[model samples]
Target: MSARSKKINNMAYGKLCLLLLILSGLSLTIHAKLSSNFYSSTCPNALTIVKQEIAKAIKIEARIGASLLRLHFHGCFVNGCDGSLLLDDTSTLLGEKTANANNNSVRGFEVVDNIKANLEKACPGVVSCADILAIAARDAVVYYGGPFWKVKLGRRDSLTANRSAANVFIPQPSFNLSNLTSSFATVCYKLYVVLGLCGHTVGFARCTSFRPHIYNDTNIDSAFAKSLQNTCPRSGNDNVLQPLDYQTRFRFDDKYYQNLLVKKGLLHSDQQLYNGNKADSLAKKYAMKQGDFFKDFAKSMIRMGNIKPLTGNNGQIRTNCRKPN
Candidate 1:
């Protein structure tokens, strides 16, 4: 072909790619119409129902709050927070709940079930499971002393769960700084920063998740590693729990960033934020100014919750969170 023809073809291809992206964006969110008062008319008690269930669970075990928040974050990564992560494994579908990243790590399904049962009773098919999950995460953060933001709703439940996507999208505890940044991309590294500071502030990691850090990693403080080594160890006790923040594991604060400043991060991925990188400055700022961290965290949560939500006639509203209708 002539060079002029080739140039025309390339320009046409570029235009086609851009047009496809534009259409994709419209299909995903053009009709989302998410708002803080989305449920005021349809299900007035939607947020309240979710908050009550989360509070009841947190009352039983404070760590359950973290689990719910984690559920929301993980769900956002794969297929844009369509509640696919909540689906139970079945003969026809290998759901995300059983995926490598979520298998034994993610928890608090019972609390979600309780919330869904109540929501169904009050307003059957009015609220989407994805929206409930997002609201539950916000309520958990507020109940645990983190910043509160109005969670926009209107998302619909995904009909199918992509287990393969779950395994690939969710960031692992063993990731380094570069991995963390790239994994948290599209939404920007700031999402990683706020989550690392806010989520880990109240969350805990499993012994297996941090064993490599406490044993083989050199960046961690010696005393901190030694202490964790006692709780976690070189082998066995895989389910043993260790607080992400050694000082205050139940409070959602900037102390998780502070811990990183002293090389006391509980997981290999946690310390990556403070280790001579672009994220180091962010970690330092949050460590020194917790109010700023809280403010940014609240904003980031809202932004993260809105990514590519299924709306309009795109997805269905699942009655039971464990399965689609």
Candidate 2:
């Protein structure tokens, strides 16, 4: 090429390099908001303390592990991971506890309260309830024999909770495949959403939530559906519960995907994952590969935890997890 052409190409390459540098810098700035060692200086033992408490809780009630994980999801899905779900309704602040999706459903507030008390004693106002939820989630997953991942901390508690937002954002058990896909896609991609749903591998659903699927749905296995129907009656006793994955309800494995393959998923939303849709292929892949399921679930959880977080000087660290400081 001529000197002039060479000079033009060189200029274009320099511009491209500068653009790449700028993009890289932006990415770092965003990532710096939440660091794995965010509490290294302020509360070095934050994770250790949280894990200790979680171990105690899990020992007493193994299902608490799933409940704690659900708490993190409930908090993160609405207005970001700002600990809004933990807030109790005050005279002026309406919390998420009474939200349609959360009322009488979400549990493990006492576990969070216990963790926050210990954290306050250790680091006073340094650790945020939001961060505690994030850490506790990882600890809960690991405690239940799930894959472990380092939680990115530094999130702050929200000053106010939005019950309306919680009702609107939290996915319902009755959602169809399209609705479920759209709900999770709001936070990340469809694949990550499916991985996140793998959390169901460890938990149970109340009869009220799964009654329709067990009694009315035609997709579920007849024998499995009949068994659940015995537990969850037709008329009343909505509080009765059944495992989401009856095969391995207490273990964090890919049996949830296996359950879906045979139409044994206890929730309509879950069965939708393998109902011959876009997510069906992926569900089959996870069911066949437990290792892949665990790996993707951990990665997807980390992504979900990184949703819109309140970091830096925004929000506050609540001394009481149920109330703002």
Candidate 3:
């Protein structure tokens, strides 16, 4: 081989290496922005502290509502105590409403307000009131059998509320199982019905017993009606939750499917994943093979948060979370 040809080959090889290196760096950058895991060497402690406080407040409020409902419905009747039906804030005058109060209707407002006030006092301008409510509502849902995913902080409140966004974002209680799954998928949740059932079954089952009297509202009876009436109620209240229980409820897992297996999964789609041929068959497959669903759930969640997020200096870094000027 000629020396000139050899030198040309070497040059081409070096160029290829350089191109690959650039691509690797680009991939890392994109990954960091997309997920970041709320972990960063350069993450501001103040930011982290604020985020933690926000999450804590949200989690606390959710659990509080859960406890309140649980206490209210102890040994309830067939129609249950209507714990959910009783949740309302029509009593509060609109003139005195706060961001958490007027914008979103939390089940337990008084308790949520106290914590919100504490955060307001501690960090007046650093956090957004919208996020406080969003995270709190999310945790409350988690408290009610929905598992938690890491909520991306740094989102600012809307100056003018988008009613369309609100109306479109939240799923209805009366939504069927297929509709529920479709709604989640419509919002790009990347939910694999089969992948989530393994760890979800137990929690879902407990959720079932939590509202034995909550037969009609939400997806309570229809989804898990057969399992709830057959195994859960027959076995007695003490035997409601099983040993493989995933308790945190804050973390995502396959328990959703397992939950379907044990309780009255309220949604038609959810029930289908357990017994029917489509998604239910897939869920049944996973119930047998215990694998991790976190990776998929997390990836999907990050994508959810990123939807229409402020990027490239488009939004402001508000010193005050409310009433951005």
Better of 1 and 2 by lDDT: 1
Candidate 1 vs 3: which has more lDDT: 1
Across 5-122, the per-residue lDDT of candidate 3 in tens digits comes to 9767655544443243223311111212433233233233433454454456446543343322222211011011111112222333211122221232223445434444555565
- Can you rank all candidates by TM-score, best first? 1, 2, 3
Q: What is the lDDT of residue 274 in candidate 3?
A: 54
lDDT of 2 by residue, 139-196 (tens): 9888778899988888888899988988887888898865654554444335324444
Candidate 1 has what TM-score? 0.89
> Where does candidate 1 stray beyond 4 Å?
1-31
> Model 2, stretches more than 4 Å misplaced?
1-32, 189-192
Error of 2 at 167 (Å): 1.1
Tell me how many residue pairs clash in candidate 3. Answer: 24
lDDT of model 2 at residue 25? 18
Q: What is the lDDT of residue 86 in candidate 1?
A: 92
Q: Worst ten-residue run, lDDT, model 2?
A: 21-30
Candidate 2 at residue 312, lDDT?
76
